[model samples]
Target: MAGNGSFWVQIMPAILFLQLLFRAVGTDGASSFSFANDCQYPVWVGVLSGATSPPLARSGFYLPPSGTFQLAAPSSGSWSGTFWARTGCAVDSSTGRFSCATADCGSGDVACNGRGPSPPVTLAEITLASPGSGGQDFYDVSLVDGFNVPVRLSPSGGSAGECRAVACAGDVNAACPSDLRVVVAGSGGVVACRSACDAYRSARYCCTGEYGSPAACGPTNYSQVFKTACPAAYSYAYDDASSTFTCVGASNYDVTFCPRT
Candidate 1:
């Protein structure tokens, strides 16, 4: 079973070690990732290595209607990166090449091949257990780059409270302002929403320049809107303390796209 908590972790050390040693991915084996699609349509899942950490076994792939994608345990070490999905993608009949309408990684294939995806993407930012962070795995859902899909994370093979699931409910994109809205061709239905930082690359919105510090740029109208819509997600860069979550000891995780209602 999986445990969910909203508060920060202050668990005992001994128990924490047990939790870490006994996780699905540990000395027993490497960490693994399970990707599930709960959306009404197909989605292409992409995972990228952060800071060129040990790359994921399958960095990119496709999940058909209600499909699931699995990967072997990751190599032992500190690994951090982002995972997201691409929508409205298909292969060109003549070229037989892969392409996505949104969140395109420019790989021209199912595999991202070390390329970064386009904006308006929902991101599952994660850091696996390492010496620096007391061997805890840190994870979160970030809307800072905008939102293309709804994401949820959970430590599935461990006891409850071991980790908290992060997911945004409801369709905030449909209500997204005209300026920030990403709509489909002709349909005019919302597909994704862009963050102010993404929409306007300025020091104020990017939280850089004189506003580089958290104290400088606390919260803007755009960030507040995102926070109000998805309180558990990283609406801006400084939302860690509240939006970020941790798992002291646990196995692998489940990254769900279009998470359950």
Candidate 2:
């Protein structure tokens, strides 16, 4: 009986291999063992047996095929991890390697291993403008080499054109000139004023003004004469030569007004 059992055991491997071969090659011995002929028969057979076995899952192992994983950094700053899968002892005889099947598979967990350091966060491009009062300003804020996370702006003192929107968040106070002010004139027209005096106070003089009707503020035309007249109150003038603002008493005052969209 023992001899008979050994014979049956030997026959089982052959029968199983033949069944797999027949399924793969469809009754044709030619295709059934073509891959086997290319390499050593024993090696190829062992590979085939391993390929047919069911895979096992091991604890703490994350293997992804083509994507990045977020693994915990080791004390040495390098990430390292391993994965293991079990199969029948018969298939385990082969030594072929397998790969993970996904990108960023281990990113969800904080403890998994096998990834590089996190990328750096980049700030978005910032722009500032005085759109004159009663008008909307347009700013095209963009991020350079940045991720998809939301960004915010920290304005120093000047108010944003539309602070409720995402684009208005990053306008720092340093970007805007202190002399520039948004003024509301008669008939509800908005004007951008550059003043020699501090315009934040109601008593300051306005050096140059842009926006409003052609008759009142000369719409887009700046005037230095306004600054001369209102040295103590507010004066405004458009400097045709420099294409900017020029205060009557303040020679160095140079401010530009942006058109509102």
The CA lDDT of each predicted structure is 0.80, 0.22
User: Candidate 2: where is the Cα deviation over 4 Å?
Assistant: 1-121, 129-141, 148-150, 154-161, 165-261
Q: Write the per-residue lDDT of candidate 1 for residues 23-113, one digit (tens) a residue.
A: 6344522267888999988999988988758777887999986999888556566778888999999899999989997799999899998
What's the CA RMSD for each of the models? 10.5, 31.7
TM-score of 2: 0.13
Q: Please give the lDDT score at residue 261 for candidate 1.
A: 59
Model 1 ranges off by over 4 Å:
1-30, 94-96, 130-134, 157-162
Candidate 2 C-alpha lDDT tens digits along 209-231? 53332344431112232323222
| Worst ten in a row by lDDT for model 2 | 28-37
In candidate 1, the residue pairs with backbone N, CA or C atoms under 3 Å apart (3 or more residues apart, or in different chains) clash, namely: 3-160, 3-161, 24-251, 31-73
Best by TM-score: 1
